[model samples]
Target: MNAKEVKEILDSAKKNDVFLMEAVWTRFFPASVEIRKLLAQGEIGEVKMVGAEYGVPLFHVPRSDQKDLGGGALLGLGISCLQFISMVYNREKPESIQASGICLETGVDESVAVILQYSKNRMAMFTCSAGVHLHGEAFIAGTNGIMEVLSPMWCPTALVVNEKVTQYPVPEPSLPLNFTYSTGMRYEAEEVRQCLLKGNETSAFCLL
Candidate 1:
């Protein structure tokens, strides 16, 4: 029941001359994008571990805690946690992936904690919860130092690079409204627009 046929879509895009990509907006966030650059510069000195957690009290929310209703922690909040891992590693092949979690009344998963072991002893640990509120923060910890993303890591504008913290002003949405983390959604859209206009199917940020 995996609706996203990523490889199929990628191949189609190449053949049809049309652009296609997953809507993983987190990948376009300033904080997530910067983390990759900083890592390439060896800012973290070879990331050995990545820890991220995302959760909220949504156990009663039908889309999160009801199996027949497509309820599950992994689909609801786990993608963001896994995004942190993808930001640091090539997930095409993991050395090993271990998962354990709890099931809600509807037989759907309420919480999931995953451990991804990779080559060179690199590893990642992340958790998603539909029953409680986590700090909503994520980090990339390496041998030299650690990079901490701001809360609600999914749409963060700031990041704490080692001891020095850097921040970006929350984006103002086109349609004025109270503050929303999703304001950063524009970054993703704009990246896509520019990519298509340039006739480039992908870029570092847009490829994934």
Candidate 2:
């Protein structure tokens, strides 16, 4: 959604006095939580850059090439990289964004690369593709050391900081799932439950 739409939704939710949350599930995962904790503790010193990539062969998927269906590598696959970058930056606005993409005949992007420039020399770079497969890893580089999220970073179960590894598996799902690590969704649900129990109108981690 655009900025105007997001603001409108936030306003409406506030006016209605109802709780609002965005299901950015990764933020609720244990590994994701650990990332924030480590950053806060200065485990890697001042973070200067974040690099991420997530790509899969989706060109054969019909919806992926259709503009009306919101089809595009950036929207369908790249959101993960974007979300991770946002989380690392705490949603701070980037001073500039540079992007490039290769579009399909159907007018949707098939591959994309982006660079988000933030203040204090901090920056984020990422790439996403619908026609190719990528390792789906992510890296956060800091003055002291570097942190890395393993492959499939969007729903990662492991992280490496300064060559030390940590793993946090998701709870098993009650039923079959179409996506990997979808069981992590339970974490997001529990967060919502806790927020409501506390009588909060929004989640501090993913407010509208």
Candidate 3:
């Protein structure tokens, strides 16, 4: 979906006075909370750049190469990196975006890379792929120090800031999960619940 579609949805939600939110669960993680706290406290100074990478071996999955299935690296997996960038930039519009990618024979992206340039020399870059497995790491660089999100940055459980490490383990789920750290989704659920209780129409951490 494009900006027009997103704007329409937001407008509709406001007109109807209903709660609306995007389920970008990573932003609800404790690691994410810590990242925000550190930034707010100026522990890392002024953020200059943010970088993230996410990829997995999904070529063997038939839907991964099928355009009709909405199959592509950018659509399926790249959201993690893109959302991370948006979080760091506080949803500010970038000055420009440049992207490049490789596509499968079926014409779906196999690997994608993007660069977002913003004012004051701020920038964000990321890579996502379905053709290969990446290190799945991310970093935020600032004037004073840098912070690194550990592997599987999308659902990160740990972060390193200037040689100091902080870890947030996933909670145990009652049911089995198909992915690692999925129990962290509880945080997202609670966020929605609390918002509804308070008659909120949107989340402070995630905009409509």
Q: Can you give the TM-score per candidate against the true fold?
A: 0.88, 0.94, 0.93
User: For residues 28-91, what per-residue lDDT tens digits would candidate 3 score against the true structure?
Assistant: 9999998988888999999999999999988788888889887899988898899999998888
Each prediction's whole-model lDDT (CA): 0.80, 0.92, 0.92
What is the descending TM-score order? 2, 3, 1
Error of 1 at 149 (Å): 0.6
Quick one: best TM-score, which candidate? 2
Task: Report the candidate with higher TM-score, 1 versus 2.
Answer: 2
User: Model 2: how far is 38 from its true place, Å?
Assistant: 0.3
- Residues 1-208, candidate 2: write the lDDT tens digits: 4689889998999999989998788888899999999999999999999999999999787888899888999988899999999999999999999999998889999999999999999999999999999999999999999999998798889999999998898888889999898888888999999999999999999855
The model with the greater TM-score, 2 or 3, is 2
Candidate 1 residue pairs that clash: none
Candidate 2, clashing residue pairs? none
After the best TM-score superposition of candidate 3, give how far the Cα of residue 117 lies from its true spot, in angstroms.
Answer: 0.9
Clashing residue pairs in candidate 3 are none
